[model samples]
Target chain A: MTVSELAQLDDFEAVALPEADREIDGAYSGDLLSWVMGRARAGNAWITIMSNINVVAVASLADTACVILAEGVIPDEEFTATAQARQVNVLRSGKPAYEISLILGSVL
Target chain B: MSDALSFHYDVDGESFSSAGQASAGVKKNLRQLGIDPEIIRKVSIAMYEGEINMVIHAGGGEADITVEDNCIVIVLTDRGPGIADIDKAMEEGYSTARDNIRALGFGAGMGLPNMKRYTDEMNISSVVGEGTTITMKVFF
Candidate 1:
């Protein structure tokens, strides 16, 4: 599923990007950085509440297909810029991380 | 061998937000070298866990990754309060991290176990109050 597909799944508003330019393969949700780093599979879309720029590093390390900032919070400008430079699709949703995860579990 | 590529990283425990930089660099390097995506992911995750542990518990550490023909080796060495009980530390959902660390979305106590899970072999040497060293291998 692409980011566009995920947007069409439920009531998850497209807050960040209009559509993902890359293909999404799996879904993972976790707040724990280390656990997510360990279990989050490649080509998967990551849903998290973390706003730190290090999240970009973790996402790159995991080779995630994209990242969805589930909480309705904006990250620092550096975060978005770096993500854009890497071509790593980053999205933000108004729903909390858990709610987004539930929505993803049902759709994905 | 001697011809294998090696990379060394200094893990800075000062900033929790910059914890995974080393692992990210390694992942990029592995990808550039044409390592299998699965193998790269495994190596990256394992090393990332180690990197976070060093920052959260050990006040910082050093990581060394060596890429051989058939295996990738990761060595993490830290100088902090060592593990008092390795067995307990290895158990799932057991962590001694402060509550502040938890608020940062870590301290789930899964770092060591995850490291073990992703690597083919894991060995730890720790001295309580002195330091700790972990060696992990992923066979390709």
Candidate 2:
């Protein structure tokens, strides 16, 4: 499912993703940066609590469909810009990564 | 298979947060080559684990990536106190990392096994006082 569809399934208060030139396919969730770096598939959602800019680097490395910042975390200005530059969909949710993972697993 | 392209990286042992930089770089290069996502993931994940192991156990280390015709080989060499028992070290929940390393979201003892899991073949060689070297491969 797309991040848009996943957003609709739960009360996320999501930070809407900018319109992308490509379509999304799947979802992946993990807190371990290395695990996500290795396991996250391209065209998939990368939901995590990591707030560092390196997280964006990892997202780029994995070619993820989007990055969902869970648990009400906020990204630094550099992060949003980097994600945008990479054309990665970046979003934020009021809920935690675990809760978002549950909704995502069921929805997508 | 020949036509090997090699790359080298020095893992920083002091920084827990920077552990996966080499793996990240390799992932980007693989994507640019239009490699299969599954193969890329396997290579990246295995290499990431090995990188972290180097940072946490060894003071730091070097990683070499050789991309051949049909497979990618990653060699991670570290100067940490080597594993005494290879079999025991391979167990999933066995970790010798300090409490500090665990706080950084690693050292759950899955590093070695995870590397083995994602790679097509893995070889680990070490001496107790010397160091450890892990060589892993992912077929294209």
Candidate 3:
């Protein structure tokens, strides 16, 4: 599923959709930025509760399709701006990371 | 060395938010140079981890990237409190980062190991009070 399509799901809300049409080939769930940076596949929808600016940097470096901020974690203005500027797609969901991963598994 | 492309940046350690800017810039430069995506990923990931470590452990540092014919070399130097135990620091689950840093999703004791994992070669030289210098290379 493409990032835009994932944004349409009821569980997720679009935060920054710079690369909305990017394809999601898999999903990776992790809170550690270093772990996610190394392990997450390029097109995976990275599911994390990390709302800091470093999240955007890691997403960009890993080339992840998008970052799914699970557990209703919302990014501050600086993070949103950086994500948009760096062309990193970000999404927010009220569900925990496990549930978000399950939803992504079902679709992707 | 004469024909190599080099880039240098002074890492600002005061702000965690800006820690990865140098890595991002290097990634962009590598992409523009048409380097292989896989190689670019390895270089950037290794450099990013080193950059984060500079900010978390050291007060700040300097990073220099040199793209040579056969490999890309990254040298990170920091003047903060140096690592007294390189072996312990290289361990996967050992970190001296404060609790606040851990709250920011780092300080999990994975920085040095991850850097080694992504690069083809890595070396560290340090003095406890003086400083630390790490040199890493990723071959093409």
Q: In order, what fnat does every candidate score? A: 0.72, 0.21, 0.72
* Residue B85, candidate 3: C-alpha displacement in angstroms: 1.1
lDDT tens per residue, model 2, B1-140: 45678889999988765767898788878889898987887788788788878888888899999999888999999889998999998997788988877655566788788888889899999998899999998887
Clashing residue pairs in candidate 2 (N, C-alpha, C atoms within 3 angstroms): none
Query: Candidate 3 chain B — worst ten consecutive residues by lDDT sum?
Result: B38-47
Residues B1-140 of candidate 1 have per-residue lDDT tens digits of 98999999999989876788899789889989999999998998899889988998888999999999899999999999999999999998999989988887788898899999999999999999899999999999
Evaluate chain B of model 2: give its TM-score: 0.96
Q: Stretches of candidate 1 above 4 Å error?
A: A4-19, A98-108
**Decoy 2 TM-score against native:** 0.79
DockQ-derived CAPRI band for the predicted complex in model 1: medium
Question: Which CAPRI level is candidate 2?
Answer: acceptable
Q: B2, model 3: CA deviation in Å?
A: 1.9
| Poorly placed runs, candidate 3 (over 4 Å) | none
- Candidate with more favorable, higher TM-score: 2 or 3: 3
Candidate of highest lDDT: 3
Clash tally, candidates in order: 0, 0, 0
Error of 3 at A91 (Å): 0.8
Sort by DockQ, top down from the best: 3, 1, 2
Q: Could you tell me the interface RMSD of model 1?
A: 1.7
Candidate 1 TM-score versus the reference? 0.88
TM-score of each: 0.88, 0.79, 0.97
If both were scored by lDDT, which would come out higher, candidate 1 or candidate 3? 3
